[model samples]
Target: MLMFATNDQLLKNAIDDLGKYVDLKDLGEPRYILGIQVNHDKKEQKIKREQKITLNQRKQIDDILKTFHMEDCKAVKTPMDVSQWKQSLARATESKQATNCPDVPYQSLMGHLMYLVQGTRPDIAFATNYRLWW
Candidate 1:
């Protein structure tokens, strides 16, 4: 965590007291980090961050699976595909029709998946990234 104070004495004291043990790196005025946009409002002394994701991000993921008629997909204990995704690119590239994956929608889903992976769904990180890049 970082702390700032209007008083230089306070800032110095705080840093001197705590700086010995903490590893601090200053990346000034963050505009983007981890696919999220951060805006600092100088007048209001406030920070605002927003990341774009489909309003129905989770629903999209579920709907895609359901549309593929995977509602009855075996309820696997784990979220990631441990075995097959490594070679998914080859299959994806060779497919003649844009049936299972299309460019525009796939990109949108990839964006949503990326945001989800960064936030609440860490377990799906590898699987989603693999699926997207492939």
Candidate 2:
């Protein structure tokens, strides 16, 4: 877990207070957590530093794509195939039970996309939302 405060004193106080109820060992600053990267160090200068946090999920995104066998896919403006989607929608209206392709890992892909949107992929929110429809 990560905690934040407006200043060092407040952060320390919060940690100390929490320590009273439970045993706590400060792990210093977090270098990375989950798929997010935390960067605040300067390699050139070792003496002075600034308190700036930079977070990114490039590695996480790559891992997710590779896991879903999409790492080799070419980038496109559309999130999904519009023609196939339309056909699916049309078939849905024709029959009460919409039988989607069993080969497609729709649920798994949606779950991962949801996690990304909730964590670090605001850019894909619209695409994910649109994909949620029948």
Candidate 3:
């Protein structure tokens, strides 16, 4: 669907001109497009677009948590825990078994987190990118 913002007269004229070349159906003002919510204020002559996760994105995160058995995990106040990272790094360097650790779905979870970071969660991008390095 095509959506354009303009004055009433101009929109009518454009629609009339385009109707000659192609069929057109007015779906009226759009409240949502793609994954973004659209808010229009006619009195202020302003429009705002907000990015929000759809039902599919919610299900994706839910599935990821379920796969890892982390559905009931407690939420942390911060995205990155520096103390935990330090302990993990220390353990990795001291233990030979760290080199032979089993494979994990880190790449898949990173991909999902990256999508969230690129969309509406810029706050987690730094932590996500830091994890990518290791």
Candidate 4:
């Protein structure tokens, strides 16, 4: 399946002429393609690509929250504490002995965070990368 967009009537006419010798089905203007929502502003002559959170993404986040028992946690203004995080990192490095921290699903959580990073939550990229080193 081939998809294309053109505003020129000459091109449309050319395509229609070629259609006589080839099989083609025009699906018309597109609103969505490959999971990304497309919005066209004809008046402004601009197009925008929007990534909406899917139901599966919502479920993944909910499941992660439930796994960590943070389903009822309150939303915070800031997502990270830089000073506290630095202090903790310093302590971990200074202590030669390994800490007996409970095994958290860090990899799984990071996988989800990566998807968020690739999607709409790019603000969390730095924090997520920092946590990966821990």
Question: Which candidate should be chosen as best, given lDDT against the real structure?
Answer: 2
RMSD of each: 12.0, 4.7, 6.0, 6.9
- Candidate 1 lands at a TM-score of 0.37
- The candidate, 1 or 4, that scores higher on TM-score is 4
lDDT of 1 by residue, 15-105 (tens): 7778688866655555544544444556453333332322224555576566555677775444655465545555667773346545446
Worst 10-residue lDDT window, candidate 4 = 47-56
In model 3, what are the clashing residue pairs, if there are any?
none
Who is ahead in lDDT, 3 or 4?
A: 3
Candidate 2 structure, TM-score to reference = 0.69
How far is 106's C-alpha from truth in model 4 (Å)?
Answer: 1.7
- lDDT of all predictions: 0.58, 0.75, 0.66, 0.63
Pick by TM-score: which candidate is best? 2
TM-score of each: 0.37, 0.69, 0.53, 0.48
lDDT per residue, candidate 4, 8-125, as tens digits? 5665887788799998877765655433345545645433342232222455567768987789999643356888678867987897323455476667777877876775567678
Q: Cα RMSD for candidate 1?
A: 12.0
lDDT by residue (tens digit), candidate 3, 1-134:
66453456776888899999999989877665544345555645443332232222455557768987799999654467888767866776677443465576677778878876776567778777877765
- Clashes per candidate (backbone, < 3 Å): 0, 0, 0, 0
